[model samples]
Target: MDFDYDLFVIGGGSGGVRAARLTAQDGHKVALAEESRMGGTCVIRGCVPKKLMVFASEYPEAIGYARDYGWDAKVGDFDWSAFSGHMRSELDRLEGIYETNAQKAGVKIYHGRATVEDAHTVKLGNGQTRTAKHILIAAGGHPVRPDMKGGDLGMVSDDVFNLEALPRKLLIVGGGYIGCEMAGIFNGLGVETSMMIRGAQILRGFDEEARGHIADCMGRRGVTIHTGCAPVEIEKRGDRIWVKGSSGHQDEFDDILWATGRKPNTQGLIAEGVGVKLDRRGAICVDDYSRTDVPSIHAIGDVTGRVELTPVAIREGIAFHETVFRGNKTPVDHELIPTAVFTQPEMGTVGLSEEAACEQEPTLVYATAFRPMQQAFAGGEERVLFKMLVSKETDRVLGVHIVGPGAGEMIQFVGVALKMGATKADFDRTCAVHPTMAEELVTMKEPVRVLD
Candidate 1:
């Protein structure tokens, strides 16, 4: 059967762009359609801009540390205008790169929404339809506000980067990574920041000890965390946004942010008769190879609700190319993925949490927490943690969790060892890097607890 193109991609995100470009480079007639920015969520409104804000927020703390190091470091008020302007420019540059790279690889780029009309047919918003031998859906997810009174008044994670001015007082709702990271960013920018989450602790799915440590550190740093609380009602009162929590707590803030959850961006994407299936969460149903129920249609990235991380989506894209285009049948490996949360005191973790590891088998836990040399010498109260969960039967590391500065960077290297099935003995025999916080990973001699 003849088709308008060999492949049609429905998103321009990291995953879609990757698959389109690589497949097009292999001499396939590939075209991509994106309704929004070319770089989609991660490059435009999500990771790139958020991480830049995280970097900007850290400068004031660094200035404080410099004063203790005998350097005259006087910090001034954060200039959100200056930083946001630069951030937007960086996003523009990145978006251009995404489009340019795809074009260079001979993939046609269409700037409009593309919906599946059939397994091989895609209809653009401009009233044109294109047919392809294979269709790829990589549309990412969007931050969703909870259903509540005056929820429209609350901003979302996407709206944070575009705020004209930082609020004097900000109330953040939710306890996930998005909410905690935003709380830190706003607090460091000199806003009176408060967070409300229904969970007993923030980062509910993480290691309990690590979550408590982060909550404690955030509280000590002046971010008021209202756990066991959630907004039941929100309204505007005079110049402030008033929120009434389920815990009977009431507060007024200059702005309210809703980071409660996210949903797949799949509305109106699949035609009614296309026979594409979606899961209970509205995520596209895809198999291990990212193939949809329909033979020629596939989905990846946040839309598939698998891992929900940018790099994982890229890997899925690569695997899709290997399977479909190269006949290699590569399935995505979702195990032992290392991830970092960019809070003030960051958290890096890979593999299972201690709670999860123990449930699977008898586990040994080793953990240490102390103020590192830099913070200790600077007279700071911030502490760092190095923890490992090991399988007692197999003698292999099941998990590695670190909470401190540069924890993210350290975890990437540690993730390599864990992915290679490195045992606890492999770490113990390795020479410790002298006078380093990470050396604690190797130097822990005994398990603090043995769980059966």
Candidate 2:
């Protein structure tokens, strides 16, 4: 019953690469196929380069505030071409690292798209096939482009990173995290930016107050926010790209970026070839154990359309190996995962939203908001937003949401506490860290409103 390899992974994303590494370390012969770059979407076009631009944009804004904090500021110029050149260099460095890691772990990395030929075999675009005892689909997701007139005049998520120079004014289509982050980056770097989302608010799933605050803060920071609007068509005249959407809303910009949404990268892979199932949204179907209808085949990450996050992908990839290959049983709780949005001010949240908790049970909602010390020092009007939802009956902390500085850095540990089923009392009993904004979590007064 020996196979050509123990595992054959398609897609070298966080999930696929992680699976290849871990399973190989576990002494499983593994070969992974990546149609594009070694690092997949997150490393190539999405998170890595996007975040580097976020840092570059924020530094200029930070420099302006340094003088108010009694620090002398040295005049500096940021050349977009030069900065982008370095970013590309770092990306190439990461790509090499991924190759080195795969090679070190004894993974046969194939630089071609893969298709599932059967339950235990995958055929590559390069006309080679590999047989494995187990197969994992971690192709990840990509930005979805809408069909409309002149839509090609604008760019989508992938094209944004390829820009040789910054645009003067940016009109962003779709108000998801991608749109919001792009808007924030351009605005921070002194570009006139406007955001348009089909939803009523920017982030539709989070706490209503937090969503409202995000919109208000964006306005307060000079980025235009337009909600409940859908783009009808795109037009170009001279150097300006003009977008006309539903309700006759017309906006023009030097550059247009559409962050509308992402589709699971499962357009192919021969799901039906082996009787694997897919959800209505075109995502590979998987259970809590990530096993598809076909027992030997499995799926994870955005392809599964479960929780579309990088960490989730990696964790699931590793957990999958533990359950199947290593004869150990471990699972990732799909709920209450911590995540961050890297916009102008940044936002972090863990666990359920107040809206979600209240829906489960009319619960207690205790919230606090303020201006951080940095904003105070810089005389900026942006405010920090923090809130927690707790179950009135069980006293369990149901959710934690924050919009402000260090939101990502602060929510991670809280996420761990939540996964352990820590109660509100546990948070309160925990000693507060002084001279820190995070301390506010432990020091908040009693519940603002406890729903019976």
Candidate 3:
């Protein structure tokens, strides 16, 4: 069938943009429609901006460390106006790069919402219908507020990047990574930050010991954590937002932020007759190759609810191009992905948690927690943890989890070793980098406990 374009991408996110650009570069006519920013969540409202904020928030403590090291450094009052202005400029620059690169690759860009009219047709926001030989949906997810009264009075994670001023007292809801990270960020910025976690512990799926250590560290640093508590109601009085928790805790704050969770963008995406299957969470149900039920349509990224990470989305996009354009039949892989949570005492983990690995077979847990040399020398009480979950039967390291400085960067390297199926003996045979916290990984001689 003759079509207006060879491919129509319904999002301009990392996945859709890469797929559209690559397909267009391969001499196929491609059209990409985005309702919002070109760089999607990661580049615009998410990782980029959030990481910058994390960096910005760390300076006050860093100044204290510098003073401790005899540098006489001191932190001044944080100017929200100047910092937010710079963040805005940086985001604008990144958005321009996304659009320019796509254009350079010969992909036609549409700055409006696009919906599936059928398996091979897309209707834009202006009611203009365009038919394509294939359609790609990479529409990303959005942060959701709690479905409770006065929930609209609170802000989502997206609203954090645009705050005109930082609140003196901030109440954050949710126990996940987003909520914890923000708690650290705001607390570091000298805000009176408190977290209300409905779950028994923050970072519910992580290693239990690591979760406890992080919660303790955040608490020690002055972030109040209300665990096993959830907001039953929210009320506004004068300039204060009051929240009543299920645990009979009530507090008033200058602002309340909701970091509960995110949901996929699937509403109005697939037409009534299009027969695209969506899972219970409204995420597109696609096969290993990202192909939907209809042959001419596919979905990737957060919309598919598969490993909702930016790099994973880009990898899926490349896999899609390899399978469709290069005849390579590449299937997306989601195993052993390393992730980092940017809390004050950060966490980087790959592979299964100790609890998860023990369920399958005998496992040996090697772990250590101590005050690192840097912090110890400066009379700081900050502690770091290094843990490894090893399979007793196969002698392979099943998981590696680190909670400390540069854990994220360390996990990336450790992830490569884990991916190559490195065993405990392999780590033991390696020499430790002296005076480094990561040396603990190679030096832990015995299992703290054996789970059979």
**All models: lDDT?**
0.94, 0.86, 0.94
Ranking by TM-score: 1, 3, 2
Report the C-alpha lDDT of model 3 over 1-452, residue by residue, as the tens digit: 79999999999989999999999999999999999999999998899999999999999888888888999788999998899999999999999999999999999999999999998889999999999998999999999987788899999999999999999999999988999999999999989999999888999899888888999999999999998899998988899999999999999999999999999999878889898999999999999999999998989999999899998999999999999888999999899899999988999999999899999899999999999987887899988999999999988999999999899999999999999999999999999999899999999999999999
Residue 362 CA error for candidate 2 (Å)?
3.0
User: Under the 3 Å rule for N, CA and C atoms, how many clashes does model 3 have?
Assistant: 0
lDDT of 3: 0.94
Please give the range of 10 consecutive residues that has the lowest summed lDDT in model 2. 265-274
Write down the TM-score of every candidate. Answer: 0.99, 0.96, 0.99
Tens-digit per-residue lDDT, 116-205, candidate 2:
999998998977878999999989888877777777777898987888888889888877788888888888777888888888888778
Candidate 2 lDDT: 0.86
For model 1, the superposed segments whose C-alpha errors exceed 4 Å read: none
- Give the TM-score (vs. native) of candidate 3: 0.99
Candidate 3: where are CA atoms >4 Å away?
A: none
Between prediction 1 and prediction 2, the one with superior lDDT is 1
**Which wins on TM-score, candidate 1 or candidate 2?**
1
